[model samples]
Target: MNVSPPPPVGRCLDMCPMRECKEREQQGRLFRFETLVGEGNWARGRCKMRSLPLADPSKTVKEYSRPAAGKKLSSPCDLRPPSVLLKTVNYLLMEVWDHVNERDLASLAEAYIFVFDRLRAVRQDLTVQRIQGRLGAFVLEGSLGFLLCAPYLVRDLPSDSYDEVLHAKQVRDCFADLMECYGMDPKCPREAEFQALLLLYDLGNMDTINRALKLPRGVGDSPQVQIALAVNRAYLEGNWVRLFRLVHQLDCLQACSFYRHLPNARDNALRVLTHAYSSRNCRFPLDLLVVLLAIDTTGMASEMCRRRGLAVISGEKQSVVFFKASFKDSGPECAGREYILIETKRGDFTWAEIMMGENEGEFMRPKTN
Candidate 1:
């Protein structure tokens, strides 16, 4: 039996986009600055940056522009398949996969959109969900890769090359805008859609999630929406027990699409949990809280505890204690601690935040001081 290897890990996935940029550069002038927003247009005269290989360009363009005379799609929703459409889909996906593997960002983005549109058009009538699932995964992965890489691509482009930036920005906006729509469109995975976008938030450390820009205008009322918002709340507030629970508890985020990055999310929550418990006067029996931290082994907990300058006693039921060193008191004014690390201020909420809701009635109330 042949089994495929697992997909890349979180850090590897985070860096994959950047690696694609480097790989594209290494391909050495294959892609010209000349834009090809259309599939067949690449063969046209705009090859100023570099002339590309053209094995019968005219024939390729003509054949690409329209299906062969004998083989029209035959109907708006064609399902009369020896599963012939499956073959077409596979060919397109192969082109996409090849472009992606070659790190040809321009070609990959164009082919991704084309394949997605074709898949969606026929997905409704397909007899097998396997193709749909594969395409869905591809779309998710491609969109995520480009989203991570776009800002870097734009930054690397020369300041004088407005055209290249425009092209890169178009590819970035295509999916970001689609996601913006998906987050609001009632026909989607519903309230959980924004949650998936937040998974991108964790992966990319994007400000759009923190500032709440990624959320759609129609969200904010549902339990899942509230729960998703609360996940961020728990994270920001150092409530790791709750944050771990929320990130792993996908009942509210059933259709979240971000993948291979989830283990990173869990690790992050545990790290934060351990960090918090390692704070001053925060001791607790390891057995009592390890499950909430998603800790599976006593050995792992003990190692982490020792590394973080904590003591772990060996026993059938074990316990770990950490000590956070205290700084010297400054003066009489410093007799008691003053709250200075405020991440949010009371009465600082804006009505603009309500745009995340359908109407003001569905808006979350602002926290008061």
Candidate 2:
């Protein structure tokens, strides 16, 4: 009978990290190498073997399976969750993914846990630039998650980084452009609709202020302008109580309804708030007004107050009260040329504007926009 040549020692063993590889190594026969140096003692110098291709060291089989290995991971937005758990988790994950994808570090950092939990293995293919580009498109598509998270993500990026600079400008400029597009006019068909939105921007009482600044091109007497005036009036009047209350309501509503199925929720809110804080209102009240002013305007309470030459002292439990003995002029043309200069109150004060008298059973008549 013809004898077959012995099979090469197992070269594939080199790539195996299993216990069998160790056992083979201990026996000094770890790999499948085709050539046999000596005859097998039991076989009587007639080795039974088959020739097999040697293992390519450069292309060895890998054992460990990483989640992000090989294929690209799909976006959280890609899969729509069916169950509540899946929905919540996916929504939460989408929040993070959208933030990171939108290049919004500030927002991602705010809800960091939500983002960090969804990440599995690191992919070599995904880069920061790619993420930012995807985010830019997402923003253009009016993704509220991106809009909500954009501020935070952009905040987290390095101040000196080019992306940071561009994104920061983009958020403000985009908001301004959108406001201009809508044209803040109380006569807007949606004026009544945007009332709550005006409050969100602290512009609820803006019509009163427009009456004060009677420019030929009147402050667009819209709900948005009213929100701006409300913020300014709150700041001017040094009414922290009302300011915080309004902001808390606005923030709560925005946070809750940001992506709710409710129709026009996000757009309405964004429209109102954007117009309110983007104006050249009195610097004093703007400083003390927190919430959107802090989120949308210049900065935090103390810095805004300081910049306006107002005294900001941290009161009990981190409450900030701004007080300054500076006089400012405010009055409508109906009040004649004798503009009233109200004296600044030093103490933490709260005063309500009295309900003005109405004409012919119109005490609470909702003024038509």
Best by lDDT: 1
Query: Any runs in candidate 1 off by more than 4 Å, and if so which?
Result: 1-175, 180-195, 199-218, 251-283, 326-369
Clashing pairs in 1: none
Task: Put down candidate 1 lDDT per residue, 319-349, tens digits, no spaces.
Answer: 7654544321121110111011111211243
Per candidate, the number of residue pairs that clash is: 0, 27
lDDT, model 2: 0.30
| Best model per TM-score | 1
lDDT of candidate 2 over 2-115, digit per residue (tens): 996432222222222234333433444422221122113322322235232223232221122234557422333222112222223233333324324334544334343322
For every candidate structure, what is the RMSD over all alpha carbons to the true structure, in angstroms?
A: 19.7, 23.8
Give all TM-scores, in the order shown: 0.37, 0.26
Looking at model 2, report the run of 10 residues with the lowest lDDT sum: 349-358
